[model samples]
Target: MTTTVVGVDGSPDSDLAVEWAAADAARRHRPLHIVHAYLSPFVAAQVAVPTSGGFEPVLRAAAEGTLGAAVARASSVAAGLDITTDMPAGEAPAALLDAARRAALLVVGCGHAAMAGLLPGSVSRAAVHHAACSVAVVK
Candidate 1:
């Protein structure tokens, strides 16, 4: 079945997006897929340090928490909604675009409008232009 894909990052904007996506999914009787892309500090640093004890676990935990919370919120917003979460390791836009490939709609949130000549945020703009499905930017 076609799904509604949303990108969440534990931000207020992301929360709004999740709610909007959930409502859309409910209206359309579709499943909702929430994704959060996390970049490991080690990978971001591009340096191979001792893996004995690092912040990787903390980062992963935080990402998991974010996804969980987002799922909860979506579930509450739309009872019986088939909601799922994915924590991909990479850039947000890339991860979102990948999820959108099989989605019927992709939803994202924007805090504010961009400059006259520019799009809102990189993720939203990129998804709007590259996603395989229609994209919605909730303000």
Candidate 2:
């Protein structure tokens, strides 16, 4: 069965992207996977007190929260849609591309307006160029 994947960074625009993806998935009757990739650098800055655990717990918690919220947002638009969460440790664009392999559609946010031509977030660029499936850039 084809699946839908949405890349979310917890930004308001990404939240909107999630909503769009969910609606599309519901219309297609495909499972939706909401992904939030947290790079080590982002996590390092997010954590002030370092631990041997290397910020796993902190990052994991944030990923869970973000992915969960995205799923909730999806559910709000389409109740009982098949939803899953993927919180991977990697660069955002690369992680999204990996997820795209099995996706029927991939959705991402254009941090800047489409009139800007290119997105403020690099993941949008990667998704446009490298997605193995259909791509949607929500501004």
TM for candidate 2 is 0.85
Pairs clashing in candidate 1?
Answer: none
The residue pairs found clashing in candidate 2 are: none
lDDT of each structure?
0.82, 0.82
lDDT of 1 by residue, 5-103 (tens): 999877788899999999999999999999988654335556442344575566678889989999999999999999888988767778889999999
Q: Which candidate has the top score in TM-score?
A: 1
Alpha carbon deviation, residue 116, candidate 1 (Å): 24
| Model 2 lDDT tens row, 1-139 | 9999999888889999999999999999999998888544444555543644666676678778888889889999999999988877766787889999999899999774222222466778889999999999998
TM values, all candidates: 0.86, 0.85
**Cα displacement (Å) at residue 25, model 2:** 0.5
